[model samples]
Target: MATSARSQTQVYELRVYEIGFFRSADVLHTYFENALIPALNRQGAKNVGVFEEMGESLPKKVYLLIPHKDIVTFQDSERKLFDDETYLKDADPYLTADQATIPFNRISTSLVHSTKEFPELTVPNSAGIYELRIYESHNEGALKNKLRMFEDEFSIFADAGLNMVFYGKNIYGDHMPCLTYMLANTDLNDNKEGWSKFVNHPRLEEIDVHGGIQR
Candidate 1:
């Protein structure tokens, strides 16, 4: 698909893997780095992001970000993964691991539709710290208000030097009425400075009218 066309129709799949104590995460990382990402790339998915939680939080978590051309591609890609001979072969170690030796304790997945204002995912050129944030609302109406708030404040976010990677409304997953977004920064100091500017920005007072959106 053309870049512009794909951008407008893109959707994201965010997968979180919970790794148990005493269990090796290498199996999971190997699968993602050596198999799943390459297989997805061949199937036209791009900019797949694999990340691990910072510090020593346990159970440790691994995050996988997959961007699809559209809903159809998202639906079709799962079946295609199993059908791909190379993927199947490459993913064998993780796929065939014994239950007792499984890498992750559980996995949670969320499906998000690209927001009207930020309809595509942009991969950063250099390595940086990433923050994934989810905002939950009281109800669908409240969620709409929150989304509108985001749309209006996107410019303020940029003006504050925040590097937004992606923004979307959650359509499926644990949080019923929520939106998720990611931000990238060279370091924690950069993030702090950006937020400082954002909160103090005059534009924020005007757009901050929407209330009760929980983090």
Candidate 2:
């Protein structure tokens, strides 16, 4: 668990939406821009991030990264957002859309605990390209080792010029026994270069020897 000046660490909600078509995606984009973000802000949530998956394909995916003070805030905010008449009216377009024209085919969510190394969630700059990486391990031992690598050797990413926003273990989500993190770069070239450096970092040699590397 991450420790900071505050006694409690941040909790994160990762929401994944799978859209069925381009029109549905459009509705979703407008909903986030006009309704959801504003509602979340009203509830005291900050650094909320909305991202579309990289690499073009039909049935597009959207990722929402939300940071909360704790589990209580995460749980209460959604209920409050629903209760707000303004939010409900603003979001009604998407919420009341015909079943056949729904904004997403399905939605998945995950709860996360911030890592000790990076306890705060940061909103990536608009000019930067962000990469969200999910690492899965086969067993608990391997999972622990992978996390240890992140906590102890994540400085390698910084040394290589990649800006890591946050790293955390997903307490609840599909494909359990995994961890997730986000990295951002102002230029795609920097992203590529930084990752190349990270993979070859000497510290990773030790992590790999301990079976931390995962496909």
Candidate 3:
């Protein structure tokens, strides 16, 4: 919704993970809050975000985005950034000398191929609503974490009028025109009133939004 105000032509994604007896979210939290965002700004990135997996289907899921003008330039600069000495030094305290916190297990890289001709949607007044989306270059990929994300972890936003909606993807998109991401609409104006109501809410404790069944 935030990007609707401007024109976004290209996107580059970097997915991080700490799973399968390896990787650690603690490290990523530190890296992102400390080094990653700054590095991205230095490299000229737009619409950046930091996400956390609130569902149990997956463990330690965090994603980041960067808008670019051209795919080739994004890829080339990304390669250099990974090996940049400055980044390495800044990323040192949180990560091991060598990316030992998480190997290449869940790491992902993609150059988005937008839908053929995308249409602009009615960009809602999603003010104060935080939005995050994660995608891979495939037909039946994974995005299971969004379930707990909207249903519980951030449910207060909905009650407070934050208006939150989130969904997972199971289909492959065609190009720039295709709606590769799902619409997660939230009432952006939910104030602190909604936040206080979250304490010990029954649904907040239950992982399943619809009783034991997955919604």
lDDT per residue for candidate 1 within 1-215, as digits (tens), equals 01334447478999999998878888888899888999999999999999888898889899999999888999999899999999999999889989887778899999999865688997766547998999998899989988988877788878987888888899999988999999888888989999999989997776675443432
Candidate with best lDDT: 1
CA deviation > 4 Å runs, candidate 2:
1-8, 22-24, 124-127, 206-215
The TM-score between candidate 1 and the true structure equals: 0.92
Candidate with better lDDT, 1 vs 2: 1
What's the lDDT for candidate 3?
0.47
Q: Tell me which residue pairs clash in candidate 1.
A: none
Provide the TM-score for each candidate, comma-separated: 0.92, 0.88, 0.50
**Distance (Å) between predicted and true CA of 164, model 1?**
0.7
* Candidate 3: residue 21 Cα off by (Å): 5.3
Cα error, candidate 1, residue 187 (Å): 0.9
By TM-score rank, best first, the candidates go 1, 2, 3
